[model samples]
Target chain A: MQGGWHRYKEGVMTGVALVAVGGVLQAVVGRIDWSRAAFPVNLLLLVLFLAGLGGMHTFRSKVGLFDRLGRLPASVSALGWVMGVTVLMGCIRQTPSHLLSDGVEVWPDFSRMLSSWSFVLLYVWMTVVLGLVILRRIYPFRWSKIPFLLHHVGLFVVMVTATLGSSDRKCLRMTLVLGELGRFAWSETDRRSVELPWTVELKEFVLDEYPPVLVLMDKETGKALPAEAPLRWVLEAGVEQGGFTDWDLKIVRSIPEAVPVAEEGRLDFVASRSVGAVYAVCLEAVHRKTKVRKEGWVSGGSFMFLGELLELDEHVCVAMMDREPRRFASRVVLNGGNGVRKEGVMEVNRPLEQDGWGMYLLGYDNAKGRWSDGCVVGLVYDPWQPYIYAGILFMMAGAVCLFVMAQSGKWKEETV
Target chain B: MSWDYFVYFAVVALAAWGAGALWAWRGRQVGWVYVFTLSGLAVFLGFILSLWVSLERPPMRTMGETRLWYSFFLPLGGLITYVRWKYKWILSFSFVLSLMFICINLLHPEMHSKTLMPALQSPWFAPHVIVYMFAYAMLGVAAVMAVCLLWLKKGNPGEREMTLCDNLVYVGLAFMTLGMLFGAVWAKEAWGHYWSWDPKETWAVATWFGYLIYVHYRLEVHSDCRKSLIILLVSFALLQMCWYGINYLPSARETSVHTYNLN
Candidate 1:
């Protein structure tokens, strides 16, 4: 068992099989996510990744492949890889068109997610068994080292906590204001309702503000074209040192149009003034004679043209404008997460409770008048807050223990 | 404390980085050189970040806080690596990364700051974001180590470093996995769902899987493990793409709660 292949077949393989059995049992009856087709889809792709590498034969044939290919020579290489990867994912995340096309609507609230039996199953299996199996195979059941023993014990703690404390819970979406506390209605009529213990009210809520973030792009990369600057709205305006004087640069806004957010708020408006880069666009113009042309920055309406907006994805447009700045009806923005009773009173974060339910502050709709003002809040009534907290604590402890052990192996080597 | 002065900070950082790079070219005691250069550079950038935070009215609600994140990750990531390895050359990398983040942040400074909306005033938020960022810095290093170990293993056909490298990869994966799980738990507290199919969430899953691949790769160390290393590198890269990419895609953006309108 020099490389431990024999031990793996006898001990680790069977252990893995036992873990798989647990997964299978749970997949059938434990949780919804694992049972569903999506879980298999995830696994299948993973399997394919392994298959592409020629399976165990290839893995076992090479020694120290990890040391060579797992990392770059220096930290800069690592950062470069990370940056390259970040940009790649960013492109995927910010698709020019929706990956799932054809006006695919969200499944109305989080039902598709929370109530997903398939996801629950897969999540449970992954959390409890796969992670443990991997750990056990690596560290085994031996209580030889302190770090090793702690790790083994820690994994057990995480499992107990996730399971006993708060594995099953649900929430609802609500719209409310400060003084006018309301009730939470469940999305599915069949689902059981949870009621809050107190008559709560949202006193006030505020969006933590930040400064205009600077963005840089390579001149050659399509990320930022000096030759073809987009019609950029002022997402923000700030004064910073430039050369000798503090140069005031206005950040162009770029808000991707998302529906769940829009639907939650009956009324919505782009931050016309400049909260952040809510929207931006890149355009190409033909020069008078040369192929090159002058590209200047302007909002969609910053210039006069029926220019098409650059839709970052099918759903949201990082373009000229979402909807031209319109006068909101309410002076007090009633966000889904905020509650307001009038100009004098405000509510947010705190729920406005009434009846047998609580109305949480989810978000607010930009408005110009009384009728237009709107807000949305996520509502939940967990009878297991304390249990959940306990479980979280256990999970954190287990995780922290696991982390410390992994980092302190060198220390262990010295001690041994 | 002006943001403009910080631009100079970036220049200084780059100079330090370049100097360190030059030192590396000369094959001298570069780790301390790298550390001193980056430490000074990051502190300068951090000072600017403090100034930005103290602004009477910050204009940083959008992805516009690019420079701020730069200041944040560079010094932060640099400090973390310095603490872990204390290697001089490694410190040089920190300076380089911090400068990169700063440069990127400066590029989009015009569009980020926004007025405080009603929802963002919660005390839990800053801590959440700050912890998450630091964790990311730590995990980022781990991911890098994983890649480096794998690559080195590949270069040395039957070197003794392979097992140790595998161990390092495992270590990184463990930390990152924990961080991902922690983030999910935090989400449950802040929002309701412990898991959302937001782009960030999905990509996080992918990243975790990448870690799993490394684990499996460890088991098969006596075999062709280059593929596994490639997977780790690829997966880590995907993590970056996911963070920046999902913002542009409208469907993912429309459904996701994590972005806070980053796109």
Candidate 2:
């Protein structure tokens, strides 16, 4: 009974009991509806939880369970349960409940682990155990314990606030057509149109793309030729290339923006920077084996036109693929309607902030591609982000301490 | 400056590391080992620097680019371990793994695209990936030590070797924690959520928890070296799944945004 293994057995048994209780509760009552615990309820619950922890600490000597819960055995058992649950989550496919189609239920508990009752219960148990461990260490107040304190406290803050504050988070998509003042947004949660505080007008949607490349594509399979490692030749103006699997190719002329025009007998492309213009390239390909040569025009066409390819033979053809976007930005002006106007550019990963909301460039009309006249922006308001950041900062300091201790060989000395 | 010059740099780095491994194996002076290993690192660094300059962007957007960093950091981690614990055989272990990566790159060079998508063009991109790669290398060295202790050590290894193993895991876990946190912060700035339980993120957290269990297990039973070594190996396997195996998993292939576009 005095051995550490005995303590681990007791701790693990306690964990199993908690999980069983959670499962029974889940079966009795369906998934937890988080929206019910929105702002004031969540705040009240947080205060009560802290007070309960303090009471547990104050009465530790009166109860043997409290003391044991603060020990390493309990900590390890709690972490093991958490790890097991997380691993199960990784193995099973997860989808947000809202995204699933109507009346489709597949492995309900394992599929949506985040919203399941068992996961919430397990996390609550871990939080309580971790809080007790921190309290036990803080009372002694050794300078060396700062790192441990930081790591535990940081993790506690992140877990508590992120879960509690999730119900209060609001995310919506705002669409702005060209030169039009838009004031409505589609809520991601309910898919309903909601009025916004400000009106947005899109000034311009600029898209910069990489130069299109020509590839030898198989006529039958439609995959790039050679199948394994297809060779791509960049179509640049006045550029020439050869050594493409017994074929020599040269770019005779290239136009960034062009439109096809029928003149007399043959169709020719002339440069025109219009909204629906596509990239057109004129190239000459010579077959090395037979000395046969072919020349024509090819274009990675737009929504209104089909892409043109130069057939080398019945087996393969030289074609231009659609250019990949290098960068896309939406320049917009926002008006709050009372002498408050803001102008900025929003791009992916570079969100614009205003009035405690972050606006990110989400999508554009894919069918129109670069000629899209409207863009969709995602708006998010997360009040608890600051608290999460504070936790991350503390963890960063703890990590530095961990690195220094390991590098200086202090950990080995202390552990041994 | 381009991938065309990768073969030359790989050859030079392999030769220098090979000489260092030989010198260490022959039980020669420790100072010479540092000279040859560092010479190899410097040569590899030169190629990466030139490529970064020529591409006008960081060379960390593709699978092949990540391999370059892995090869560079493996030997550097080995040197750090040797300096701290005076374990000379660590060089041989790290160099062999490094050589394997270099050979893979030589056999099949990935397409080197100069363009990066809008979502990947963030300031956090470089540090998040670089830190993760470094952490992987450190954990890999610890895994190698675990294998040696489990199989090769005659019987009942002494406390010194176990201490070395523990030290490596501690450092590796620290770096891993930093890398995950950095990724979370980046995700928030880019996508508006700190964590969405994406398949890749789920696997990553599972790996972190796997290592945490090992650390606690070691603390609980210092006498049971066999169980602890097995735990370390299992944690390493989870790390591999987190790193690249997620790309192949059917559950992750459709929903995961972290998959590398091979095109």
Candidate 3:
């Protein structure tokens, strides 16, 4: 019982120390903001956690430090756990279209790509400390298994590389309209355009743009339901037409205690996929008199009262996934590609690269339209490619060595 | 001369592979196979780089260059995997895979040669592909091991299979671990955080976790049935998604750092 107690204590202490080490390493790596209370407070917690773990483990002395080491490996294990699934980390922030649509709070934020100040500081910190710690060696030290060593070493290199990537790399974008192509994308902005390291003529850009997706809504009540798209929208209903479809009012289930309504008579549209009944929507008598335009077409999430102009500036576009609808765009894509040269509006998803830095297709100029052509660029600088390669090499070498050892009759003979 | 040159490179690679395979089939001489594999790599390394560099435009931005890069991945992978030990016909396999892929690309003349779009203009594209492919190749090696293990269980542990599988698994694990790191680093620079939980991201992490569990099991249980199966299953499935499954997801079209071709 006494021995068991000692072992438990050792285990707890080791776990605490590992966590502390990891947290400190994180801080040193710049994952925390030293200026803020969080980092400093976290540092205190690190100390306490470490002390707690240490005290918990070392309180009983039946087991030595060596035996308690593996528990700490769990921290590294956790680190691996966090890093393995990378898609969850949204580096780029995408603003949803203004047009009323379903909420998407769970969606990844693309804003991470910009690398905020806190991020940059943490990146620098992570780089320097990760480098030192990797080379210097931490608590559990042994080169018995090359794969094991390489794995840890590789992770360190990766961390450093990521930090370098933040500072060194840049991104940009250029657009093509159908058959258009170009040898270069764009520079920091429209005024400056950088040629590609290699030339590429656009062979083709398959629009594959599907027909407009539609959502049906009632005339009196704004209860929306899904419907076949590209329908002729009649906003105003005739006085006699209100019989078929009832206004699906989202009545508040609240009692007398609830806050009073802010305003009445104006119904906020509620979205639904399908409704049991269809409503008749007739054009308003006076509204039909002037056929200049109507703004009732909901596109790319932006509902525009349609104008009479046949060519709508903002076209509804969707980027879908898993049969579920994703984000929609209602911006005009001005393909500035002319003969051999190509250019266009850049969005976060779209980017152009020239020289070495990449340019994101931020947005386009509305006033100048396609005629006023320019590209916005995001630049990146990376110098630690060699280090990355080295890390990969070492890690791989270690793995090979370990694998060979496993096959060397030593491992099998002993284990079997 | 150009025709002769193309034929020469192709023949050289093929010959090296054939010889290596024959030897593996014979007695599984890893060293000889390594030498032959590397010889082929040495022969094609420059050619491959030259081919990549020779593009008059951002060849990678086009579907063809993507195919070409994938093709190059095998040889490049063979070159790396053989750094310490040679697996049976590993180099040859990479060469053949690359050649086959590139040849298929050639069949589609319309998709040939395109310049980088503003999005593809990012220098990250090359490294991203390179690192990811190497990771793929490494995993390919691992898959070979997994196949061999099954074969071994069937009492068909050909000497070549054992050596190759064992070596490849090691190499693959290393590459995967490194790939995970590189990806994170790249993302941190490209995005802010090191890891995200997108489907692809989820699968990548799952792959890593699978490997981690494998490694952990190796240290603790040392290759239990449950662990091995879990590891193998996760590795293969995640790999499949990484290669093809994720792309099919309609959500994949969403703008992401991991998004390819769309840029």
For residues A1-416, could you state the per-residue lDDT of candidate 2 as single tens digits?
Answer: 36536667876787788778767776787667788888988899889988988888889999988888787778778887887788778777776766763333342466778877777787788899888888887876767777777878998898888888888888889888999998999988678898888888999998888778778989998887667667777654456664479788877887888988888987688999887898988878999999889898889899866788988988999888878888889999999868599999999888999889899897888788899999989989888889989888888888778888876666534332
Instruction: Report the lDDT tens digits of candidate 1 across residue range B201-230.
Output: 766655655555454444443444555456
All candidates: TM-score: 0.56, 0.95, 0.46
Better of 1 and 3 by DockQ: 1
Candidate 1: CAPRI quality band: incorrect
lDDT of 3 by residue, A13-63 (tens): 533454455445544552332224333454464466445445534542564
Q: Which residue ranges in model 2 land beyond 4 Å of their true spot?
A: A1-5, A101-108, A236-238, A411-416, B221-223
Q: What local lDDT score does residue A265 receive in model 3, on the 0 to 100 scale?
A: 57
TM-score of chain B of each: 0.70, 0.96, 0.69
The C-alpha lDDT values of all candidates are 0.43, 0.83, 0.42
Candidate 3 C-alpha lDDT tens digits along B1-263: 11114446656765775565556446566677667756665665555555556543434554444554565566656656555454545555565566676566545432212233333444555665665566666666566456546644565445455445444555456556555655655553443334544556656755665555454444332234433544565666667765556666554546444554421
Instruction: Say which prediction, candidate 1 or candidate 3, comes out ahead on lDDT.
Output: 1
True contacts kept of 3: 0.11
Question: Candidate 3 versus the native: TM-score?
Answer: 0.46
Ranking by TM-score: 2, 1, 3
Stretches off by above 4 angstroms in model 3 are A1-41, A48-416, B1-16, B23-47, B57-110, B118-128, B151-153, B156-166, B183-202, B225-230
What's model 2's TM-score?
A: 0.95
RMSD of each: 13.4, 2.1, 18.7
lDDT of 2 by residue, B102-137 (tens): 888888766556678778888988888888889989
